[model samples]
Target: MAWLLVLQGCAGWQSALDPKGPAAGELAWLIWFFTGLCAVVWVLVMVALVAPLMMRSPARSEPLALDAGAEHRKVRLVVTAVGVTALILVGLTLLSFFANRTLAAIGSDAALTIRVTGHQWWWEVRYEAAQPSRILTTANEIHIPAGEPVRLVLTSTDVIHSFWVPSIAGKLDLIPGYVNVLDIKADKPGVYRGQCAEFCGAQHANMGTFIIAEPRPQFDGWLNDQLRAAAAPTSADAKAGADLFLKRACVMCHRIGGTVAGGTVAPDLTHIASRQTLAAGTLTMSRGNLAAWIADPQGIKPGSHMPVVDLDGDELNAIVAYLEGLK
Candidate 1:
C-alpha cells in the first residue's frame, strides 16, 4: 500500500510527467496539477469500494422478499448524476489549464530563431537571420547557447520528419513547405539526445542527433567559427589528400569551401573535424571510423544516401589527413 502511494507520487511517465530541459520547471507544475487530480480520483474510488461492502444489506440474498426496485432506481440516478458531474468538472478544469499554459508558452516573444531543415535521415541545422546568405550548415548536430529561449523553425525536404529531444521539449513535426515552430531552451550546459519521432524510411531507426547547449561566450565562438569557410590543408600529406578528394568520386555529392564540388546531396565537409560525429550522427568522427565509412558506407548504414569510394591506400590516407585538417 505504501509502495503504491510512492509509485503514484513518483510517476515516471515521459514528457507529460518527467521533464528534463527548460520547460521542465513549467511541466513540473503541470504534473503537480495532475497529481492533485489523482488524489481526488483515488478518494472517490475508495468511497465506491467501501460503499458496496458497508451498504450490502442482508436481505440482498432474498431480493424477492424486499422492496428493492424503488431504492435501486434512486441509487442508480444519484450515482449517474454524481459520475457525470465529476467527469464534466475534470474535463473542464483540464481543458482550461491546457489552453492557458499552451497560449502563454506560444505567446512568448523574445526567442532566437533556428531554421532546422530535415533531410532523408539527418538534420541540417542552420542559424538563420544572424547572417544573410551565409548559411552555416551542419548535419545531425544542433548547438545553441544555454539560458536563452530558442525557437526552431522546422521543415522537411522529402518525407515527414519529427524533431524530438526528450530532455529538451516536445516533438515538432517537419513537413514539406510548412514550417512548424517549437520553442525550447536549456538551463545548463550538456549534450542531449534527439531522434526523428515520425517513421521516415528504411534508415529511420538510425535517425538520431545531439543537442549541445553551451555557455553564451562558447556558443558565440562556435558560431563565428562555423561562419568562416573551410581552409586548405597545410601539411604535405593533407595537401595531397585534398587534391585526391577533389579528383576522386567524392566531388559528385558533397561540398567543401571554395571547391567546385558544390553538391547538396550529402553533408558539407567544410569543417568536418570540428564535428563530434559523422554519417548523420551515426559513427564517431575518428580517423578509423572515417576510413571505414569512406571505404564502404553501405556497411555502416545500409540505406545511406552516400556510396562507397574506391581509393588506393596512399590516396585514402591523404584524403583522411585532409578531412582531419578541416577544423
Candidate 2:
C-alpha cells in the first residue's frame, strides 16, 4: 500500500501528459473532475460534522438551537434544495461526459491496419493490405510510422488475450476468430512497452512486446526491407552459419527473408538481427542474449512453444552467427 501510494504520487494529476492508452486523456479529465468534487464534498461534510461543537452556546448545556420560525424553515428548505440540486447536477454532468466521449473514442477509426494475433506466449503480427492482397508476417515486435493513425485489429489464436501499450493505447481484448479494432497514434518517434494484459497460460508472465513507432521515411524503409527475403551471407563463416541454421530444426518453425525457412509457427526471422530485442521483447537484442536464448529457450521463457533444442558449442555459435547475419 505504501508503494502504491508512492506510485500514485509519482503519477500526479498532470502525469496524463504521458498517456499511452486511448481513454487516457478523457479519464484524466474525469480524475480531475472527481478530485475537485471530492474536495468540495469533504470540506462540506467536515464542516457539517463539527458545526454543533463549534457553534455551541455558552448559556446552554445542549448544542445551539435554531429559531422555530417560518423564515428559518424557508431558509433550511432552500439550502437543502440547493444541495440536492448540486448533487443531481453532478450526476448528470458525469453521465454526459461518460456516455458521449468514451464510446466515441473507442470506436474512432485511423489509418494503417496491423493485425495482432495472440498466441500462447507470443504475438503474431501481420501488416494487412500493404499491397494488393499482400500480408507481411512477423512476431513480437510491432513497428508503426509515427505521426500517423494506426488501427489495430486484435485477435487470439487459442485463448483470450489483451493488448496494452502504456505509451500508445489502452487495453483491448483479443478473442478467437473475432477482430477487435483499436485505434492508436504516437506524437513522436519512440519505443513503447506493451504487454498481454490478460493471463493466458504458464508463460503469460513473459508474454510482452514493444511498439517501435518511427518517423515515416524510416518506417517505410524498414518495412520495405522486411518485406524482402533474407540475403545470402557474404563471409565464409556467415555462410557456414546460414547452412547450419537450415540444416538444423530452425527452419521448421521460423521464416527468413529470401530463404526456404518459411514456417508459420514462430516469428519471421527475416530481419531478426535488426531488431532491438529478442525472445518476444524479453531481452535487449544482443549476441550474448541471443546465444543464451537459442541454447535454452525454455529456461528463459518457460512453457514457450519453442522447445529446447540442445546445441553444442559449434552449432550454437553457428546459429547465433547466422541469426545475427540476418540483417
Candidate 3:
C-alpha cells in the first residue's frame, strides 16, 4: 500500500517520474536503472550477511579454530566485493558523463531561444527574434511550440532561484549576476506547472509558473496576439477605467505596450488579461482577483516588490476594469 502511494505520487503533472519530454524521460530512466541496480546489490549483500548464520557451526571442542582454507575464501570474497563496488562506481560515473553529454546536445540545434530572467519571485519570459518587431515579452506564463527544442538562457536579478518543471526537465539554478543555459522540449501539447525549487525568500511557495506547449501554428498565433498592443477602450466604463489607471500611481511599476504608462520595474501588463494567473500564479486571473491583487499585493504575495496602491472603491473598480480589458 505504501509503495502504491509512492508510485501514485510519481504520476502527477509535476512529477519527475512522469516524464513528458525527452530530457525528463532520460532522467527517469537513469533514476529507475540506478535504483534497480542498487536494489540488486542490497539483496546480494543481505544474502551474504545471512549465509554465515545459515552455515553449520563447529563444536566447542574445536576450540574456535579458524580454518586456513576458510580464511583464504574470506579474503578472496572481500577483494571480489571491493572490486565489484569499484567497477559499479566507475560504471555509474561514466553513465552520468554520457547522460550529461546527451542532455547538452539536446538543445544544440534548437531553433528558438528564450531569455528567462528570474525576478524576486516572478519570471520575465522574453522571446527575442532577429527583427525588432518580432520580439515579445511576457510574465510568469510561457507558451512554446510542441515537439521542438527551446534553449532557455536563465539568470536572476536578486537571490538564488531554481527553475524546475519536473515533467519537462530537471531543475537548474538561477544564480544572481550570472547566467545558465538550459534546453527543454515538450513531446505534446499540455500545461506543465513549475515552481522555484530553491529556497529564495518569503512567499517562495507562491512563486509559480506554467509552461504551455501547443502546436506550432497555435503557438505562433499566441505570440502574434501577445505582440499586439492592448486594444482601445470600446465602452465608457473601460475608457474611464483606463484614464484613472494612467493618472494614478499604477504607472510606476507596470507598463502597457500601447499606452504611455511605461514602467520597467515590474511585470509587463500589456496583455495581462490574457494571462491565466495573477500575482505569479497565486490567484486565477479574473476581475475580482485582479482587483484584490491591485488593491493589496502584499496580501497575495508577501515580501513582493509590488507596493500597495491605495484606491477608493470606485478607483479600484476602474483600475481593475481597465486591466481586465488588456486582453
- Give candidate 3's error at residue 15 in angstroms: 0.7
Better of 2 and 3 by TM-score: 3
lDDT of each: 0.76, 0.76, 0.86
Best by TM-score: 3
Candidate 2, 138-244: lDDT as tens digits: 88888888777788889988999999875565578999989898777766777666778898989786777777778899998988888777877877767888888
- Which is the winner by TM-score between candidate 1 and candidate 2? 1
Query: Whole-model lDDT for model 1 versus the true structure?
Result: 0.76
Query: How accurate locally is residue 284 in candidate 1, as Cα lDDT from 0 to 100?
Result: 70
Tens digit of per-residue lDDT, candidate 1, span 235-283: 9999999888888878887888677778677787888888777766677
Q: What TM-score would each prediction reach against the true structure?
A: 0.82, 0.80, 0.94
**Number of the top-ranking candidate, with lDDT as the measure:** 3
Ranking by lDDT: 3, 1, 2
Model 1 residue 235 lDDT?
95
| Ten residues in sequence with the least summed lDDT for candidate 3 | 2-11
RMSD of each: 6.7, 5.4, 4.0
Mark the 10 consecutive residues where model 1 has the least summed lDDT: 2-11
On TM-score, the stronger of 1 and 3 is 3
